[model samples]
Target: MATTSDNQLRNPPLSDQARDRLRAAILEGELKPGDKINIERVAETFGISRTPIREALKALETEGLVQIQANRGAIVEPQVWQEIHHRYRMRSLLEGYAAELSCGKRDKKLIAALQDNWAQVKKAGQAKTVSQNSARSIAELNRSFHRMIWVGSGSMTLVRFLEALDLPQSFNDAFYKEQNARQVVCEHHGAIVDAFIEGDTAKASTLMERHVLDSVDLLASQADDHVSNLCC
Candidate 1:
């Protein structure tokens, strides 16, 4: 049984940290679909015990990233393209409705915050080279912009559902790193902000739905490439 080091004690619960690491590994494709997670090996690598590793795996199971089996360990879930397509479609509908609701109650403060967030996103996307850090930053900024609109909808249920349906950070990180994709996203965001400012609920809703659905093709293509590479 491994023991947590003194350094680990000062941070978040070992299980939470382990969960995050395992989640990242799955999303980043370090752990491909159907790959068995060796709990004991992970425990040794993290210098912790099997308990935390098991706890982490359980959390991921709920997130649909892994499937735990009887008398066996967790297996990474396959990234089914149809499932991914359906998720994006649902997001388009929910987020578009949220945008409509938000536009009905838009205020200067919400507009200002979105403007600030967009500014940061644009700045990060303009980097000469998209470093991993910059990509992560842009992804976070984009989420912040969308979340502001979601919260502005004043419906906690809608927000909760959207949160649950959100794709893993790794997907956004890769998407925003491409110059063309980043530019297109920024344009859509700017147009949506303008619609909100004008209090055009219909336009805002349409733009938001289109904005989200637009990425499905790119993401699907990337997913196919990823699966192909893993297969080879």
Candidate 2:
């Protein structure tokens, strides 16, 4: 049997901690897209060794949050609007099917859970001002709300596929920051839940697909604005 030291060596706590910290930094926009990550600087900031930071970057790379270059350090991956649009299209398809399947199941527990989550979503939306923290809070609640539907679909394969197509938190952050975003989300989510209540699978699926696709326009606008800012 492997000893304690072996397990510790294989899974070092420092690496995991560094990875989490770095991930938060990236997702929170502290490390903007295209920002170069200097390993030495990060190591000093975290008061850890460079090895864990390197390992952390490797992990983030698999998550599509960063690209590591040979002989050079890593840089945050730029959010290409075209690629994001494609991802949303795929999400609409998979998540739409998930909603249909979930509705067909008529899982009362799932419905209740969605309702509860939606309440939290509305509460978060009631914030007086939109800030990064509030946006993050809403994004997390939004994720939980959708994830319940994914699980309710009763198909692990579908869940895995949906998870694979998931975008980084930064996109969600931007979406929630837009004007009338909270109102839009509340309306869509409330309608989706009502569709579920009436056991309307088609309506549920259609609403879910539209709900996802609708965000594409807002996000595209955000991307255009970002480009404009950079150009000017």
Candidate 3:
């Protein structure tokens, strides 16, 4: 029997499956930023042919998760400062809009829910030894708060756009662990919520932008000093 060629065996659907799995590893930091991905090894691990792995990696490269380097093959793209700045800049704008819309909503029930979750996040952040559970729990609480704000915007399109942004779970974990970030996040997020509750659309928008930018700065400063420490 003749063996199949890569062109014959590799299909778009197979590539997508491979891409999703690899993307998860990258986002979860299992692959780690700046780490070289052994495509052959990945293929073997996933029980797929090299063709699928290649296709998957190429797709991820387009998504900014992986990069093709000269003589080095594919690497899990590091959270480069330029890229970080660009992303946060865009996020700041979007989140500010979300807050502005949320303020218009004046959803008392939503505001109350957000306040409750924000408090939980703050309490967890203050714990002496921030365990994996505490860190992840805080992350989830933070996600909820932001999602609530987005939903309150009453625009499914905006919510989907915000959701489509490339926010890594690893990045979130690392960010919360950064110096002063925990303290700042609690205050920043609370202020945004308060602004929304008070029906201050302008203030809410301002706070959201500031909060996003502050996180960008904190992440940059900390990542520069301890990339591996924060990322893992």
In model 1, where do residues sit more than 4 Å from their true spots? 1-10, 79-84, 167-181, 215-232
Q: Which candidate ranks first by lDDT, i.e. highest? A: 1
The candidate with the higher TM-score, 1 or 3, is: 1
Each prediction's Cα lDDT score? 0.81, 0.80, 0.77
For residue 115, model 2's alpha carbon misses the true position, in angstroms, by 2.5
lDDT of 2 by residue, 1-232 (tens): 8556877867668987787777656544456677778888888888989999999989888877788998767887776344457778999999999999999998898999989889888888876578998898899999998999999999999999999877566667767876577878988999999999999999999999999998776555454443211110
Better of 2 and 3 by lDDT: 2
lDDT by residue for model 1 (97-211), tens: 9999999996889988988887787777876579888888889999999999999999999999999888667667877777877888888898998998899999999999999
Ranking by lDDT: 1, 2, 3
**Most accurate candidate by TM-score:** 1
TM-score of every candidate? 0.75, 0.69, 0.74
All-Cα superposition RMSD per candidate: 5.3, 5.4, 7.5
| Candidate that beats the other on TM-score, 1 or 2, i.e. the better one | 1
